[model samples]
Target chain A: MPEPIDFYFDFSSPYSYVAANLIDALADRHIRSVTWRPILLGPVFEVSGNRPLNAQPMKGDYMRHDVPRLCRRHGIPFAWPEPFPIATVAAARAVYALWDQDAEQAIRFAKAVFRAYFANGRNIGETDGVLAVAADEGIDAAALGQAIQDPAIKARTKAAVDHAIKLKVCGAPFFLVDEEPFWGVDRLPLMDEWMARGGW
Target chain B: MPEPIDFYFDFSSPYSYVAANLIDALADRHIRSVTWRPILLGPVFEVSGNRPLNAQPMKGDYMRHDVPRLCRRHGIPFAWPEPFPIATVAAARAVYALWDQDAEQAIRFAKAVFRAYFANGRNIGETDGVLAVAADEGIDAAALGQAIQDPAIKARTKAAVDHAIKLKVCGAPFFLVDEEPFWGVDRLPLMDEWMARGGW
Candidate 1:
């Protein structure tokens, strides 16, 4: 592996789920390494002046048509999880809690959240659904939620968003390999080449 | 059509070309309407702090893998247009200027610009190239450039960016139907559905 890959994802993004499914395969074949990073999107948006894609008439129009086709093409399960545009605050915080303990489980929790929102039509912002996601990952939901609520963990999650702003990130489903940041799932191939060229 | 579908686009983006090509076909089948728009992406990035996909490492990785595959799947001609990241100022300005005189010509000019950058590997920001693009669309390139540079036109272009920010848009190849926004070409199908539902 030339360098380890850093994947900065948010639980609320459908494209992030699509990207997550391919990360391992990408790492194994291209860089031979990968890291899971779940960050809060709210702060990133604040700094970037971006609201949810649905809030923008044109962008929301695109997502309705494109996402499902991608899911079908990838052979991955997908749907517009209910309560269109579920809040991601709690979900992002939970990810902050899961980071250090186990990376694989973090991915599991992340995918479950994606499945909940984009595929299953569940409200990810609520306690029960999120806890259900954690439990599905075999995580101690109560404990993890407790851990996340810790002031330090909460602050760290905020910092992630702040960092994303400082880094000038524009949208969800972003990736970075060796300091080079790739912004969307659509940019996957470009990142691969940069890696093949040994990711500058 | 319940009402005219407002299509938001930047002449500098190749994805818009890809979307524009077949979008008409899809709209015809779904009985939707499309109104072309020309917006400036540079200003959108300026306010949003969003960098190109290649600038983000992870996103760049994804792009390396996905873009070519998408091009192949869509049967749309594509390549990494040279001046890898060309300055799109003039390209966008030209389309905006032409829009006032002939909207269809504006679309043609936009496509020609994409073909130049993505297919011919030309520099879109260059004056000569931009003029050539106008000529290709049977318009007076020099005249168009001068017209867009006028105070009112310049302000109008800037206003479009401001409006996009107000709507919380940070990226290109955007579309809006019935006041709903979709951000990328990938979202065209979703736009189609929304338009269909609106009786477009």
Candidate 2:
């Protein structure tokens, strides 16, 4: 079997939300599984000397228009979150916490968190909001609440971000197919072709 | 008739080079024409608080890998030009100079300049290099060389850049389909859909 595709994402990135929604089907087509690794963009952006998209001068404006249009194109449910690009440490830790117990459940939790923040504008940056999203996904909310604060889980999330940085991941929704990197939701088609052609 | 697509591009940008190579064929498929407006990124970067892709930290590295992959994917001829992200004012001025004499020829001049810099590794940022590329296109060498230095041609290129800034063009290969903006070569697919469906 081929190596599972490595999917790195930040919870607060809307483009990540789009990729999270679409990646499974993409993987399914190639008979590949996915390894969902949640990362925080804060540290990554600092290392890369990049700012948040919404904080950039003209790009911020372009993203504001582009995100909604992308959602409409993909038929993904979306509403721009209030106080966008929130601190996603809580959400990332929560996924790591879930991963320690159940990988499938963790994927569900990650998708739910994305939908809660981007689709419902539920601000998953806070522990309380993320817990609520976990509960809605039929997860044990109390366990997740406690797990996010667990020292081990927090370290796991930190290590994941460090790994992404080490890999030179510059943005959310970054993918690695056997160590070939592809960034952005826009790269999905290209990635699909890459997988289909077994690398060009 | 539907409105023509406005293509804003910088000659030094690799992605813009890709778009410049493909955009005409894309337009032809939809019974559309493109208006290729050459603009310099230096002023746009200043106004947008942006840096060149090759100057950015991790993004620069990503771009180096991504450009050749994209060119191979699209079957476009490409070679990374040394001294990339060069000052393109001379090339921009040359396009404008050609525009004043012949609009269609200006578009040809623009494409040839991109090919010279990206495919042939010519240093198109220099007046002599640009004039040489123009001459290869059967343009009058001395006339085109003098035209590039014309104060009016220089002002025209500057004004075009200013106009792009006024339109909030944040990057190279930005497009406007009836005033709805799309940025990047990646957006060409979306722009095609938008034009096909008459916007979403």
Q: Give the winner by TM-score.
A: 2
Candidate 2 local lDDT, residue B44: 92
Clash total of candidate 2: 0
Q: How well does each candidate reproduce the native contacts, as fnat?
A: 0.02, 0.79
Give candidate 2's whole-model lDDT. Answer: 0.90
The candidate that achieves the highest DockQ relative to the unseen native structure: 2
Candidate 2 chain B, run of 10 with poorest lDDT = B94-103
Residue B74 miss distance in model 2 (angstroms): 1.5
Kindly report which residue stretches of model 1 are placed more than 4 angstroms away from their true locations once superposed.
Answer: B1-200
Model 2 residue B6 distance off true place after TM-score fit, in angstroms? 1.0
Whose lDDT is greatest here? 2
